[model samples]
Target chain A: MLAIFVEMFSYDFILRALIVGVLVSLCSALLGVSLVLKRYSMIGDGLSHVGFSALAFAMVLNIAPLYVAIPVVVVAAFLLLRLSENGKIRGDAAIAMISSGALALGVFAISITKGMNVDMSSYMFGSILAMDNSDVVLSICLSIMVLCLFAIFYNRIFAVTFDENFARATGINAERYNALIAFLSAVTIVLGMRMMGALLISSLIVFPPLSSMQIFKTFRNVVLSSALLSVGCFLLGLCVSYLWATPTGASVVMANILAFLFFYSIGFARDRMKG
Target chain B: MSLISCQDVTFSYEGRNVITGLNFAVDKGDYLCIVGENGSGKSTLIKGILQLKAANKGFLTLGDGLRLNEIGYLPQQTNVQKDFPASVWEVVLSGCLNALGYKPFFGKNEITRANEQMQTLHISNLRNCCYRDLSGGQQQRVLLARALCASHKLLVLDEPVTGLDPVVTMQFYHLLKEINRAQGVSIIMVTHDIKEAVSQADHILHLHNKQLYFGSVSGYMNTALGKFFSGGGQDACNLR
Candidate 1:
């Protein structure tokens, strides 16, 4: 295994994969803070599936999948917001619609293009072992955009996400901030799908923030710790996958979940002992 | 001058009319206590005033001279919010977010204001504590302090002392009185504690069957419903 990793880790191919994973994880971690705060944990999952479905169609139509998928997922997120506001579906019922519908659509598109260079294994789990230059660049760009958004709108986002009514009475237009969250969620989901794949992507978004909230008492702590955990998970999982030729998305997601559970359980124990 | 006035404000949800055709008003520094049976629209009326839910049929004007930002609100504590993972400082700091105009970090002035509000609410020491880890009464104090941090003019609370002890309830009332007298902030509170509502409230709104008995606290307490409705037997401090 050491020999395997030493050889692969030196190769530019593995380096690119590592870069993509780390960058995407960082962005997802930031957005995960908002998603967890807003109680829209499921939206990240829903949008990722929508991206997957759009990816298949883009492939069949011979277009760049990110272009098609990003717009469609963003629109789907907006629709989810509108539908929920109108009471079209109550309490995450819309999430079920988007997740299941998008999953089925993805499978159907894949079946139609099944013979058109179908690398089912790679798409299902993630093709980190085979990532190209553009994927690495795309991930870097998304991460930078996410950081930029955070820098610019941190206060409004904090106010709206934590206590929306307070934001509103203070004249901070919560609806706009809520829309920003949904829009950012769509973009993050699209970029994240390439690294974690549709099947395992949401784990990074959910577990990092959840675990960080365990020991940290402040919103800023939760944000910073989650990003740190995410970067660490991505680097560790990438190394393991490069060494063992494991399923890349599953390996990373499992590693993140394990790390989260470990720390969360420790925090729980410490709290109990104190009590 | 009347800072807030309502006329025939009706509100409903899912076919049940909660607060029906209510009419009332609050002058600056008036502590209005609103009471009614469960599901009789006491909370609904409060929510209506805060614009949490708009009136379906009538109007509530927060006075034309005042901007929307002047009205402050403190919602009731819910069981679900008790587990929120935020600190007392963070919670109090959230109040200034609207005033600070969306900057990432808090500057010296915002920090000063937040600290002042917490100190005024007598919870400045709890600033470093986790909001969810505090007792029920402590949580209420934290939220009240948070409200005070942003409470520029109007202070609206929905059951401000829901689960607090009797002594704490009195302290809560005293704090409101201090805020009202010092800042000249008008307050309207929704409560189930009838005797306290009658005794402390400057004005009383006894809501029943889509009608509002709008008058001075003593006037309403002298009525038959107020005499009976002030928790007739359970209450020890009966009016002469």
Candidate 2:
């Protein structure tokens, strides 16, 4: 087992995947707590679909996918925020409309251009070998920035998520912080889509916080546990993928599912014991 | 000078006038209760005062050094908060976010304020407990502590005791009364319970899509609008 683990790390592509995966997991977990609490968890799913279309367009244009996809997804995220805030289109409805539209656009772009090629399939389903050195460097820088921003604005984010109206009443710019959250999610979705695939990226933003919530009761504890759980699950998923030759994204999601169930059972038992 | 003065303020929601011809003033250390039936625009008026919504016409002014952000607010609980994973300490500390300005983390001063507010609400023991795990009354206290941490001058509460049992509701009311009397914080509360409103508040602003009556509780009791709305007659007077 030790030898196999060593052999997996020896592969350069695997090493790159590990580094990026861990960072993306941490970012998603941190943001997921706020998103889930805000009832905006579907925003991640919506943004990933937008990212898919943006990546398709970038490929057709022969440009850097991150450059095109990041801005496009960020814009889509802001648009979704505005649409939901306006109340004309409810949040879930707006997300559904935009995600399905973007998904259709992505499929159309692929059909018109690559016509279901290996590269397109990799983007849709994810491939561990898809990330190059440049992608790795970009992901690291952006992920570090996301992490720092979250840490710095931690209190404000907490205020916004817990009680936006109260936060706004107290003079905190709730809208701005909300926009900041949307912006960060956009960047993280784009960054993770390369490895996790557009279809699976939102699971990273959803599952860990939910799992942590089963066992932890406080916001800080839940956040800390979610981060730890996300990273741990990602590593375990990577090992599973390496050993069993399973898809990395599916393996990671499976790991998250298992963790959620484990935590849920413990919480249920603890409640029963207390009763 | 009054802490807040409204001169012919009218608020509309989506081009429909919810509140019209609103004229009132809140003095420092005043306890004013806004009582009305549903869709009577009590909430719209509250939103107008909180600056969450703008008046379609006229002016609303804040005086006595009351900035817009300094009005502590205890809004009705949303569905999201019912299951939110937050500690009493975290929720209370977050009330200081406005004062935090560009600071990334809470300073000692903010922490002390949160602790003091928690103590004041008698929930210091529950500081580490999950907000979602608490009783409805305890959760209201936690939120009240958070609102207190935000501003010392004024508090705006919207139907604060909506779902609690009678005992907890009375306790919450008494707590608010104490905060108003002892801390000298001005309070503008919107309540469906007119009996409690008349009993606890010095002033009443009765609304029915417009300002039906706005004056001292004694003066309000004399008015026909107040008499009619408070279930009429001798029982209304007995409430006070």
Best by lDDT: 2
Tens-place lDDT per residue, model 2, A167-209, is: 8788778899999999999999999998889999999999999
TM-score of candidate 2 to 2 decimals: 0.96
- The top-ranked prediction according to DockQ is 2
Span of 10 residues, lowest total lDDT, candidate 1 chain A: A115-124
TM-score of chain B of each: 0.89, 0.95
Clashes of 2: 0
- CAPRI class assigned to model 2: high
- Report how closely model 2 matches the true complex, as a DockQ value: 0.84
In the order shown, the candidates' DockQ scores are: 0.52, 0.84
TM-score of every model versus the real structure: 0.91, 0.96
Could you list the CA RMSD of all candidates, in the order they appear? 3.1, 2.2
Let me know the DockQ for model 1: 0.52
